[model samples]
Target: MALVLAAQRGRCCLWALRRQRWNQVQRFVKWASTIGGHNIGKILIANRGEIACRVMRTAKKMGVKSVAVYSEADRNSMHVAMADEAYCIGPAPSQQSYLAMEKIMQVAKVSAAQAIHPGYGFLSENTEFAELCKQEGIIFIGPPSSAIRDMGIKSTSKAIMSAAGVPVVEGYHGEDQSDECLKEHAKRIGYPVMIKAVRGGGGKGMRIAHSEKEFLDQLESARREAKKSFNDDAVLIEKFVDNPRHVEVQVFGDQHGNAVYLFERDCSVQRRHQKIIEEAPGPGINPEVRRRLGEAAVKAAKAVNYVGAGTVEFIMDSKHNFYFMEMNTRLQVEHPVTEMITGTDLVEWQLRVAAGEKIPLMQEDIVLQGHAFEARIYAEDPNNNFMPGAGPLLHLTTPPPDSFTRIETGVRQGDEVSVHYDPMIAKLVVWAEDRQAALRKLRYSLHQYNIVGLSTNIDFLLSLSGHPQFEAGNVHTNFIPQHHDELFPTKKATPHEVMCQAALGLILKEKMLTDAFRDQSDDKFSPFASSTGRRINICYTRKLSLLDGENIVDVAVSYNQEGSYKMQIQDETFLISGEIFNEGDSVYLRSSVNGTVCKSKLVILDNTIYLFFPEGSAQIGLPVPKYLSAVSSVVMQSGAVAPMTGTVEKVFVKAGDKVKIGDPLMVMIAMKMEHTIRAPKAGVIKKVNFQEGAQANRHAPLVEFVDEEAESK
Candidate 1:
């Protein structure tokens, strides 16, 4: 009994001593920052994309030199150019480059940087990487390694929240991860349970099993995704919530047990469990509920001794009851909206705090300024179920910057949206006096934004902004599904006026090329000068095709002298005249039709033309003549072909393996999403053309199938 008392006394003394030291450090930082900016001499950013660029801007403002590390694919990225010094860490694939801990550390040491800032994704929340920085005596511009470990694992975080008196849904988080154990838990939780991988983020490795019959299959899929994404397949089961809003509170803490909440953000607008749009001061939340949420968040942060910026997420029911979900111990993607409303630069605070600075403002000093919204712009086709897209940015434009508008992007007009990284192009943030005004600005900005060569969700975004239900703030996790028809209206046939604009675009492109050639030649007059119109009185026909759903409409164009053309569709004909003007990376085409002059922004990419106006856009294609189409057999339905350019990840069947309808053939991964190719019909796999880990072209054959009759013979 005496020994036990003595040991307890010793432990109390050690805790008191450590607490004293932490308080001293906190006091020093708070004093130093107010007098002058905390000086971090130099820092290296160990990530890529817009978030990396965002950190560098703040670092420069703080008088700190910045270093950048990039994969071979990102060698020419904007972040690399923005940094004072840059280095290529490894090859294009992320594992060999951006996620290579040793390479990132080596660059930091070589550049003599005093700290490393991991921008959101890649290695931002990796506790092992944070520990490596501590061992090297280099500061990590994020929460401490201890905090990362505690909050990164979903099971551990839930347990900690429960101990702190925070409400958490029933979930099985255990050491025994056998399939049998998980099955038993699912049965207890009842049907429609949520199976989530404990070590995963970004909505990966999460699945919903609605019945016992489908539980095992979904569990296996979730495990595979988890293992491939996070290198950990352990999972936890929880009761799924219906009609829940994803609300999260921002919190900050220091070494001296000082913590404050920075209001809340409504991230209920999501797809694939990833946020698409986010707003500050979550809609419909009252003062009392907000206060309770803030208190809960602060408590959660203090439980982990969290330092730096973090978000404590919750799932709120329709009646305003909220439950703790998990904590993200790093910067979040939708942070810009928070900054807009709070009038604070979260990135700047991160830099100062990492350099031993403290929170500059107390709880009373922080106030919400106005309403703000952030819309993520992605290269995807809304018509194709929002599948990710990759291509060159043949044409690009964005809303002009102002006090109420902010455009955050890491790629330029001519850059390529590679298949190896996220397809997000930019974040469009708007601020205003109220929600209605902010939404109006969001709609205007969406109309102003434009892209070519690949499809984007700009039109869909505009539709969503004008949605009557959305305008009334009727939002939830399942909002999109409930309003799918209104958000994505059916595509209609192209108008004749639009086809005329496309013809004008093609003519303008030819004229520019000819003019360029003439200027490069020594002789002022070249024989290949741009043709003004069809030769004298002769008329020539050109065919134009526009894609709508699964079919194509062909329109005929007849050219006459002096920039005149006639577009005809079976029984209808429209005589059109247009003039085009070129401006900084954009072309404006003015078309005169039906005694009205309509102007449109034009973009011509190879054989395609895009016309952007006030309402939306139209894609026009220069179709090949029927004679050439017959000779060039570009599409083969019988052969398993890649839908986009990517690296093949797996082949389930080998040469001569028999396959039936809907059987798995291969897995093709691109832009960080996986697509499995299935056999279309019963047949024998005559040839597995490409091996695993091989590069594939768009629509290139992967496996060739011989007819069953031919195989039998």
Candidate 2:
């Protein structure tokens, strides 16, 4: 009566054990009869973006129709289109839409949904939300409300882990949240302690204090972030682990008290305490240690009666000593890598367990497969310290998904990556025969990914994948800091070859247009756009202006004959030749600059040209004459401007406030990361132009500075 693989059994006892699945099915039927006398019929996903889509796919695969709820901003979203039915919740802001529990429940009830799958973030771990779903007679596709309550708070979870015989990091998880009390606890825990939000995950509301002098400030920052993100300022302290690897075990459980561990994933290579890349099988893990970790995770799950997909995260040191970090009581962002290695659909498992069914596979039946890795593609500029960018995705290209690779995304070309949500564009996953093969596939895939319109971290991801240390698998949580230089080398100046290519492309384009008009014009004395609609002479002596960050280059192209031109950069001259073709919105250029032939995918939008090749990318801006573009230019600022487009969240000073270098002046939040703007030098704040909660643009001055000499003048 049960459907399991033939490989699940190697002996008669195992077959006998599987036959007991009939009992599990009978138990589920009795329980279902008490509830609604059915399996999951119609389900509602109480979330948005890629996660919503992910849950819908699994639901459809199981013959269950899905409903979607969307805000005004997401009416045209991909998930809304993919769902069987959809309802509008509220405005764009999450508080009025995604987090509106009553509205979501109303929609679910009106749609006659039997279960609500709170996919990952919004209300997924909220105990009150889970309980309300149960009270409304709708299945909450997650752990019981009791488990969410215990593990949702860090302080309570640590106590629970300790009681369950799981190792915990030594620190204070107390009721007193006073600053002075927290400082004392940090002192006792010794310098370099981790101050974390009691209810935080995903790197928000976490800070590391190095010593006594900096502890209070760091604690306040952590609390502010926590309060803004989670509405709770409760925090806990922990002894900081040095260069520890972040490894987590994937665990599943059923209502029949059955639990199993899938495997472990190494998420050590992270930035800002959040994982950007992840892999499964946790390279170099001791077989015995892996056994212990799996046992411990299963034990932790049973202690809380966890029923669903959960991740038991741990911090392992260089000596392989591991401690419980926290347990995410839902599917994780990096769950795909685990799926790739185990050949398991974690979402399907979540659905079946939520329906009171037993796990299809046991620990012995689940065999590990090849290695896999996941790279999180974000709309961020890594060279600018990973400043998030929000805009339309003008051009998007990615490697075609195959058996060995998968692309998980929620947005399409021309969709706007809103600033209100996480700026992750997609997750690129790859698998190969082994770790080294997988690493090689990841690098090749990154090269195939080409994006334009907004800044992205594709180049940075490529650099990280190619780094010898990363390729060698010598990874840690502090891997970025350890190899920042190699990971993010200095942006080399635009090569003369590339600049020459740009000039040739522009010149050839102009000539092609002229020839086009000459051929199509009816009148002889005028161009196509003129009243005569006739051929007209077009100038070829045009300047190709290129700007790469602060460095700018200008080249002039002179026509020699048909399809030939001479390019001049500075005092040097080169016989540069090239051909450009316009295909859809992309520009392809094949040019010879100083005897080196180069071919590149080029994108020219307004005053900028983007070149993406196998080696790297080049963003060069074309500037008009000084007189033509004078009104649009900002006279160089002597003080700080908004580094990127963000909301001015806080203002610590006003006009006439004296500040020293490195003093915190304001806090600006963009793409979900808070960046504190500090005084650039010892000066007086001349004026604060933007008020709190105001939108600030990149290079828009927020604080004007005046030195003593300027004040005297």
Candidate 3:
């Protein structure tokens, strides 16, 4: 049956091709009527950040003047600087600027733009916005508003697919809101169902409920989150396919009723329901399945009269049965991989299609050239719950883009990674002949990339790329959390390594002091040493190393100015710049075993020298005649602190709020993102030092928690 359907579709496609060829004169006339041979003169972009910049790059290449709309916070953003003209839409919050349709339209009018390109997020998928563009007599460089409306709603899109004979995941997409109703639906569908917001993207307002209790509990939370994030609380329940591979087909269409599929991309590697990595030519998709997937996607696109470029996403189970997911109506972050494989510029096609031109390529012309992968490098700490890191990027560097690798970014050194935007620093993509080669190139690019003064997940990405299982391509959706222990081993530096570091620190200090004395010794004399032969004193202390197998090591060094020195271990001699001092108050020591060298700060207090290594202070008795006492005091403390450097989103606690354990005291929205901070324990909030829209540094205290004493019975 499938083969028969394929044959019919192929025949239809060929007939359409013949008709298109025969009607070239009529097609030319239609094209002239729509575009009038006038290329886009000016384009207004209704988005911000890297995506906006990405669109402008293509716009400029096509000789189109680009206009950028930005909020006050993004005045100096790269996108603003890249545009031929820029206008301030509103303040920092997106509600006033990016999502403000009136303001965006005003900018378009003021800029005299011939078209409006709603780059990815913001209002890209908003059917009303697209409709407004048409009403204003400006080209909307995307799918038709009708197509957007058709695919904008999950339930409606699934129904449309069902009508088109496309396979869809079994679930309930009705308007039922009752807990019992959803619970019944979950049971009918089976356990382990996915609750997703109908209007949500980017993994927001999605939850996985395993049982009846969980379904009820997660439903309200998902609704609330969906409302807050996307202003829509309506959700749909779908059957969760275990170990499913996320795949999507890129499709393009024109006004002449022609559409073509550009193969598929695998975006299965994800965290928190958001994709962190994506690749082209999915790892395990056989040739037969690939052909079917492409055909289905083409049918899906044709069902909606889709124009311009769009994506049809799917979830394929282990048995190779694929189910239709959602369709993205705009350009995707992972489009670079598809470009790498097909050598097609989707942005260019979007412009050409919007201008009423036919798709420039046919099915046979589209061919997968090689494997490609893209890793989204984010300003977040992988070691600390992936909390978004926001601060001024003090330094940024990466290798140049070549045939094998590409780096797409909108930031540079001295740029502020503000909390009002996504924390994605850049997208690192690599292309090679095969999957293994692509993975290797990705790992190399990640290692070579460097960003300072802000935490990033570069190290974590490198580790994941190089992991045995990941390299072998034998991973599932739950791979990260499942094998986190093995991938992220909890191994601290060995005692010998610490000792070696300490020795190196000492050597560096000695060299610095020696250089300082050589440059300015004539200006000032040392207080511990006279001009002749008086002794100098040094004191230093460092942290003790605790390693595996109960191994511990402490490093402390002290010296006096006199030429005579006392050694604790007579067999070991401290190497100080190739000089051996038999008797001296100032003695330099380097651990020969570990290659650690140190300069000591010797103090002649009660004939004892003190050693410090930025960790702690230690006292050493000089002259070999006194007993030694080593005491260590280490301090450990914790409280309400910012997990990462980000702008304060909201502070819920005040000077004296009684709070129970697990109560949310504050909410932080960073990198144009959001997170909640809960109470560590049952306590009274002593003080709240931050407010909404304030900058908070990493580890800075935002509130004080005073523990409540047990009441007397």
Candidate 4:
């Protein structure tokens, strides 16, 4: 006890010293920033989620106050809590909240903020919003309005790039946006043409039509999404580069007419035309090619007289030949990877440059250091075509963060991944001395990220990172689909040993609870109240039912007097013994299965058992009662249901409308992407449960259907 007390005292002293050091660092930063010449003292972050919190971190470091404007849905978000002042702009929708330019501007004025930082997405690339800031005498921490205007529109940017002698893809950028005109241009460009919105970024309004037959439908889909996201429906048809790699360079400029490039990042692997993983500097890019890419990006920035942080994107074919795609007129979602490689805080640079400072480091002064990788962790089901999900983040745990690794996030454990906005949860970024080491660190970190509430692509990211071709740096835009077979292999039954582990976890947990209850009562040593399956003389046998997906497995356990047990599953028996212990609010199981001992993090929530090991994880479900299962099945089989929670954008059928299988019934928008709910069979619509603009939850019946023959009868 004396030694323990001494150790505790030492820890307390260590903590105090660390706190003192941190205070010293903060004071030093404040003094240094005070010496820097900048008039803006406070800035309003006209955004939400991770980016807002990210900007606040740099702002706090610089001793600048930050004001956060959030929607009603983000009342309890981390960004709101971190801000010096927070205001609710409007309701949950983007139009009423984050994208409401006047409302945000009003908050900036009310809060006495001198600047507004539109942290990407909503108004980051908005030309009018930048112009509004200029008119209001408030600094917009981005490029000039003219630069945003030139680069925000793809046609204008392409023309500027061409005039700047940069290579551009063949596309139709004319003002004629008629269906006939766009179709004709697409035909001239050849089939497999790319339909993209003129004012689109982040793949929100982009589609590839593989053939002429699907061109019109794809065009209409892209236009609708573009209209909803950017409020513009004009599209440009371009030649789709088959299996091209997406590479982009990060460029920073100042009002003093100085610009520099922070190298390039490879964002080739994607889904739904959006990037999943990004790395820098681009793999397999030699020194000469890298120099050319950076120079081209710098030329593009200079052509527009760009300012602040921006990304110049390119599409590279197999021969390493590349063409300009489009320039993002603001800090990108994947800027952390570039920051990690270059050892620079891009957001801090944005603030300083926006304050009329010259480029901190010139082109020759900047240097690249290590390799970095950033994986976007999102709330989506990889098995269900990556459909986005919205729910509470019930149990969230992450790898220990260090200088080499970072978990950039906005939501806490109880916060919901809202249905009204993007489903991204966090970004996992890591850095190392080389590409191979960085890739290994990424996989290691992913294995430690465990989530229980909603479906995530963590496991899928592991598979993709470890794939052979990915390791060889042979990645393209079609990496996921091209390697689908290996990435998504056939599911097999739960291994018997794993099943034994699950059963042991359940039994041990029960024993712990029973012991706790007995200890609290007068009958502390009552064997009758114990749930350990202990018998007086003979072994006690009990049957356990566990669900793996839709299949149920039966396990027979015989408890021995020696505290070990024999679990039998389909003619195989194993000796298992385990104990449940608590370690810092988390429950863990240490089990010896057939003389092999292993430990795993055990989470039993909502009738499911999650076992997270060092290398892999397993999910076992508790069988639902028969009555409850029957009720759910009936509700599910009633009619076609919403695949996810979303707002109904368009409904094609009312009551009594007839439709066949695969017929488009309605269009729903969720997570800024469009999805079409189709008919499951030929039937007459009995009821239209959801109307246009109505929000529908997952598995809710959208359109009740009855068979035509049954209706006639």
Best by lDDT: 4
Structural RMSD, model 3: 11.2
Evaluation by TM-score, superior candidate among 1 and 4: 4
Candidate ranking under TM-score, highest first, comes to 4, 2, 1, 3
Each candidate structure's TM-score, on Cα atoms with residue i matched to residue i, is 0.88, 0.89, 0.77, 0.94
User: Higher TM-score: candidate 1 or 2?
Assistant: 2
Clash totals, every prediction: 0, 2, 36, 0
User: Compared to the true structure, candidate 3 yields what TM-score?
Assistant: 0.77
Model 1, span 327-368: residue lDDT tens: 988999999888777667787777767767677567897777
- Weakest lDDT window of 10 consecutive positions for candidate 2: 1-10
> lDDT per residue, candidate 2, 76-150, as tens digits?
998999999999999987889999999999999999998999988878888999999999999999999998989
Q: On residues 62-157, what C-alpha lDDT tens digit does candidate 4 reach at each position?
A: 888999999999999999999999999999989889989999999999999989999989999999999999999999999999999999899999
lDDT string for model 3 (286-306, tens) is: 899999999999999999999
Q: What is the TM-score of candidate 1?
A: 0.88
Which parts of model 4 have CA positions greater than 4 angstroms off?
A: 1-31, 34-36, 525-528, 535-539, 654-657, 708-713
In order, the Cα lDDT scores of the candidates are 0.83, 0.84, 0.74, 0.90
- Runs of candidate 3 with Cα error greater than 4 angstroms are 1-36, 494-674, 682-706, 710-713
Better structure of 1 and 3 per lDDT: 1
Where is model 3 poorest over a 10-residue stretch in terms of lDDT? 629-638
Whichever of 3 and 4 has more TM-score, that candidate is 4
